[model samples]
Target: MMQHCNKMLHHYIQQSHSNVTIKEIIPGKLQGRIASPTSKSYAQRALAAALLVPESAHPAGWSELRRMGLCNDTSAALDAIQRLGASVRYGDNRDTYYIEGGFLRQAPAELHIGESGLSARLFTPIAAQSPTPITITGHGSILRRPVAASMVAPLRRLGATVTDGANGCLPLTVSGPLRGGTVEVDGSLSSQFITGLLMASPLSEAETRLLVRQPRSLPYLAMTLEVLRTFGIEVTHAPDYTEFVIPGRQQYRPTVCSIEGDWSGASCLLVGGAIASELRGAGIIVENLNPRSLQADRAIITALERAGAILASSGHLWTVGRPATLRSFEFDATDCPDLFPALVALAAFCSGTTVLRGTNRLTHKESDRAATLATEFAKLGVEIDLSTPDTMAIRGISTSDGSLTVRDPRLDSHNDHRIAMATAVAALRADRPVTITHAEAVEKSYPHFWDDLDTLYTA
Candidate 1:
């Protein structure tokens, strides 16, 4: 039988002509304005909904998917949907995309997740809900990424039988009628598992109550609650998220939900401004942002504030402006791991030294992010020393030459959306252009990321 498209895959390159790279300089004064992209978290939730709701599962219904913002991660989420069962068609008008969603008649013998850690983790539970056996796998560097066996043990206990090549590694096989009851997962590993179980719980024979072993990322669970509400799946939970009560049966309403713009993606834009002080002062504004969001990346504002960046949040709109003197400060990234890259960029431009903690979660991303950041930043005369496995100290430096140098122009994102966006932002501030080898990796989160950057970078 054919395996999931995780190992030994192929992508036929379409664009034959090469692109150009230049020594670009982000003026010391650059503007701090760019529309935030769509939340990949929202996109993943929507894909799961489209698959679960029998009525909306079809290629033609995909046009119902609209853009709240630029979505590279959502693009990968849609790709996984299509690869699994649904067929999606983009309308000719360039404004509409169609989803042919429906439960797989026979479990797709193999479910391939192309470089999406969220897709791989969340879909495992969803696939286990299906009638037949399904094997899940992911491409690129995810093969070696760790999975919390502690997280999977519950799903196995509740019914769904599973198998994998290594210690809870990818190529996860699930066959089940998830006998959902009580499940416990560690929030520190990855919240996507919690989201997967939550998505699969409504259809389970029994209600599922989750007990977070050590709650780390509460914001992610909050985002899950918001998405579940959007689908009309009412979930009742205690304030502490220590418990969850999911009704056995659910009716998913076809939603005209407008996904909120991503604070995660916007963090990079804000940090870019913090690095290039020229963009501050006036005429740089970001609108339509929620001051109160369940996204941990919202802490980017706090990090910027700690580093001497100006921030003003008015209801749904927020703005980040440059400060006269940026200072170095230590930060704990336990909750907001995704912001590490953006924070690193800002940290590099600050005076003195900044030490960022919580590197444990950095391994399973699109690439070995800590090493990637250190290696790339090294080319620009910035000093990043990883003394411990879980801590990194960055010594800031001032850019003397107009072009901030990057040694490896051939750097690849290894298909991590955050990496792609972060590298693009670094390019803006660097004296030299950054030609990310796998530039297409942005599809995992913000598909139109380059387009959005083009608007501001060329302005």
Candidate 2:
């Protein structure tokens, strides 16, 4: 299985060099079940925590991780950890990772995070724990996003010396024996750096007190806290997540854990199921998702419910089908901004106008998500209004007759994974085939996305 997974990863890497054109869907209902991909969100946090564990705590100081994600972002996290001096090896199944933590003894001169924004932010503070100077860099869209306020400022306040690349972005040279104390962090841009701080603070000689302002994506913070707990680290926080108190000089216990299934990736599949389900039949069943996950994107269920999509769940299985009539629904996605792309696709098939708030959070993502979604979906005749600063109003193309005509069959993914999946899902109900450039962007979070979409048709 490990060899198979590696081959699959190699296959996607090769496909990324060319375009993947999705053929038009004929009049047919989607069927079959696909397991949700492992949650990279959980996997990354776990991997970072594993790097801090003492070898004395467990045999050879190894932390076992199961159900690891096969996405580029998680891959970046793995690579970042290895560069920082932790040893990693895969089990026979390739689904389990045995990480021997000991990064403090030796620090790499450079850490490249690839295109993962989360890795760039989550590793900055973690990397700052080293007394030696370490340069953090990445490729693709991540280099273009601003990080000064979210990452550099806070690390500097904690006694880390940080040099910005050019315009306060990546390629940051950071050095520190990070001291724990009271520090203020602006949380409006992202919560990833805050997670980094929480994980790294335990190594400081003094206790850490974080004063976070304008915190967004609180659910993701909860997820970080949960991972910290699993590794036997303690963190106390304010009820509203405005402040956090972490004890210093704490040790991370090596433990075996399993990552949850990702709702972020499953969202596109669920939207596809809601859009393509027959009037009377079993809809698409997505297995392995936790209904009560702390991940912010779990709000997809609420949006589906608001849109009047039929949903039923038993244990880890969720089935989504189109209702007798789909209605445009209002959603506030400030905390779960990643859901915007999938929700946009779901709204495209609903009647009337759907208003989604949290446009302010979309600017620093893999792409300018709000602008990209509007631009690409318009090619399918979907009307999206972005004139309002904090809101996006999408006027749905009435699919009363079961299909909508694609205004232009060609589109672009803007090298963003969510955008790629969203466009592919929207095309399921299109009158014509849609061909998307840079479609391989799905490898970022969901490496098997195209394959899973195919299962719906072939089944």
Candidate 3:
């Protein structure tokens, strides 16, 4: 059998050359059942944890992960672990991964994380656990994002030597055997590096105390802690998530972990269902989601409820039904910024105006998400006002017939995954077909997005 890592790399190369043109959506034409993609967020974290497992914990030294998401981000995580001295094998089905966990006896010269932001941040600290000098770098939009304050400074405070590229961007060279102690990190930007610290601290020589300032995305921290627990590592944090306490000199227990479905990708399908389902037609059914998942994007259910989309659940399966009309709703996305693109697409089909808060969290994503959302949505005839730095007000154009009048225009994804998915969902109500450039951007987190969307069309 071909190695899963090589297969994933091949998929990435193929996706780089693909594009998609979404035709006009016919009302009552979309109805189907599809499983949500595995959560890349969880999969990547789990992969990182797997690398720290000592051979003594599991005689086989292998951590078996089932139902792992093979998206580009997760692929980067897998590749990083292998380069760092782990062995990976996939089941015939390709969804089960057996990773022999232990760092390589020799350090790699450099770690290339592709365009995954999470990989760069999460692995930087994990990489710092080693004493050798290693350079962490990425390509495309990630090279343009600022990581100095969020990643570099925190590592420095923890006793690691980090050198950043121009403008505090990627190509970061770091050397460390990170010393553990009380350190303050600005959490206003992202929760990813904080997670990295939490994962790395246990291996340090002394206990670690994290003083987090203005922490955002608290749910992700919870998820990180949960992943740590699964790997037999312990972390304690305050109720408000302002501080974290990790005992050092701890070793990871290699074990099996199952990745959960991705709500971030499923949100688009649910919104598409709400827009395409007729009054009496059966809506879309998305399976494999856990209602109690700590993943932040699960808040998509709240937005759908506020928009008056018909929702029902039966165990792991949730179905979205059509409402007589989608009502404009307000949502605070400060803690769940990934939902912004899907929420924007939903807002374009709701009557009146929909206000979404937390535009401030959008600047450093795969694209400048706030500006990208505004620019692309405008081509589809939706007006998004970003006059306020922290808020986005969307003026929707739904008619009395519950249909949207959108133009047939060319859109660009800015090589951002969420932006590509958002535009495709918004195009469902267009009067004419919409062509999206860099449509393959969805491969970052949901490689099967277009295929899944097609299933609904053909159903």
Q: What residue runs in model 3 are displaced by over 4 Å at the alpha carbon?
A: 1-28
> Whole-model Cα lDDT per candidate?
0.68, 0.86, 0.84
The lDDT, on a scale of 0 to 1, for candidate 1 is: 0.68
TM of each candidate vs. truth: 0.83, 0.94, 0.93
lDDT of 2 at 27: 32
Tens digit of per-residue lDDT, candidate 2, span 145-214: 8864567778888889998888878899888979988999989878988898999999888999999999
Model 2 TM-score is: 0.94
lDDT of 1 at 207: 79
For each of the candidates, the C-alpha root-mean-square deviation to the true structure, in angstroms, is: 6.7, 3.8, 4.7
Segments in model 1 whose C-alpha atoms lie over 4 Å from true places: 1-29, 54-65, 68-72, 79-101, 104-106, 148-152, 277-283, 313-317, 398-415, 431-436
Worst 10 residues of 1 by lDDT: 2-11
Kindly list the per-residue Cα lDDT of model 1 for residues 1-459, writing each as its tens digit.
212212112122334464311122232344546667767777678777766655442333332556534354455567666655666566576534555555564467888776667877778888887678888887666667765354468878878887765876787788787877887777766777888888878878777788876676778889888888876687888788777888776755545555667788777777766665454464245555567778888898888889988777667666666676679999989778888888888887778899999887787777778888887677655689898768989887665643456665555565566766676666666664445556666665666655555555433
From the highest lDDT down, the ranking of the candidates is 2, 3, 1
Q: By the lDDT metric, which is better: model 1 or model 2?
A: 2
What is the per-residue lDDT of model 3 for residues 337-439, given as tens digits with 9 covering 90 to 100?
9999999989988888999999999999988999999998998889999997699999988566554555547778888889888887767667665667776
The top-ranked prediction according to TM-score is 2
